[model samples]
Target: MTAQRACGLSDLVQDEARRVEIDGVPMAVVLDSNGEVHAIGDTCTHGDISLSEGFVDGDSLECWAHGSAFSLRTGKPLNLPAYEPVPVYAVTLDGDDVLIDPSVTLDVN
Candidate 1:
């Protein structure tokens, strides 16, 4: 898989989400409350709003526009207004660098 550098680990704050674009695909990279990193499609499946602009509630990211909460790990919508799951990318930490592969989705079957 083609892994691209998303950002530095120091660039992210715990429990906050950041927007990053790799290969023209917008991604929402979040540092969860547990200090783990997750990467998901930035756009909300239920709306055109960016998930990066949303608030992080525990392991879920809530869409600011419609209040749809998406799981950080599976990219599945946890609450309604959104039924479809967003694409989740595989994240790799290379030293202090945060790398993401947009071509490799980590969603559960």
Candidate 2:
């Protein structure tokens, strides 16, 4: 899979989400509290809101509109109003660069 540079490792703050678009696909890249990076579909499963605008709680990202929490690792919804899971992309780190493959979506079933 082709990996596109999303942002620098320093550009991401812990427990914050960043909105990015790669290959015309909207994505949400997050740096969790443990200093790990995660990439997922930006749209929330429950609504049309962007997940990047949501709050990051540990490994889960909570939708600001509906409070739907999704796992960063699997993209599975952990709360109500969102029964469907979003696509979780593959993230790689090359030194201080954060790369994401929009074409590769990890199976979260």
Candidate 3:
């Protein structure tokens, strides 16, 4: 599937994550302090919590339930309790829009 507009760029705050659903796929869209946008699976592997409801630190999104920090760049959890990595999606900036394709997940190493 092609990229679809997830949200407006101006709607995101730095170091914050916004929960968005594209084609029924739940994702957490974050705007880092460096002014870059990222999209990852919203569900925490350790728990059934929403990652968007968690905290954003540097390039990671921490699960509020068990403190499992997932890398915004690779979607890998940095601590225990979450062994599975979330899916990271490609973000496209178009003017004031943040575009993402739910069917396309980045193969981050």
State each model's CA lDDT, in order.
Answer: 0.93, 0.94, 0.97
- Stretches > 4 Å off in candidate 2: none
Q: Across residues 11-75, which tens digit of lDDT does each residue of candidate 1 receive?
A: 99998899999989999999998899999999999989999999999999999999999999888
Top candidate, metric lDDT: 3
Estimated TM-score for each candidate:
0.97, 0.96, 0.98
lDDT of 2 by residue, 1-109 (tens): 5999999999998999999999899999999888889999999999999999999999999999999999999999998999999999999999999999899999868
Score candidate 3 by lDDT.
Answer: 0.97
Over the full model, what C-alpha lDDT does candidate 1 score relative to the true structure?
0.93
lDDT string, candidate 3, 1-109, tens digits? 8999999999999999999999999999999999999999999999899999999999999999999999999999999889999999999999999999999999998
Error of 1 at 20 (Å): 0.1
Q: Top TM-score: which candidate number?
A: 3
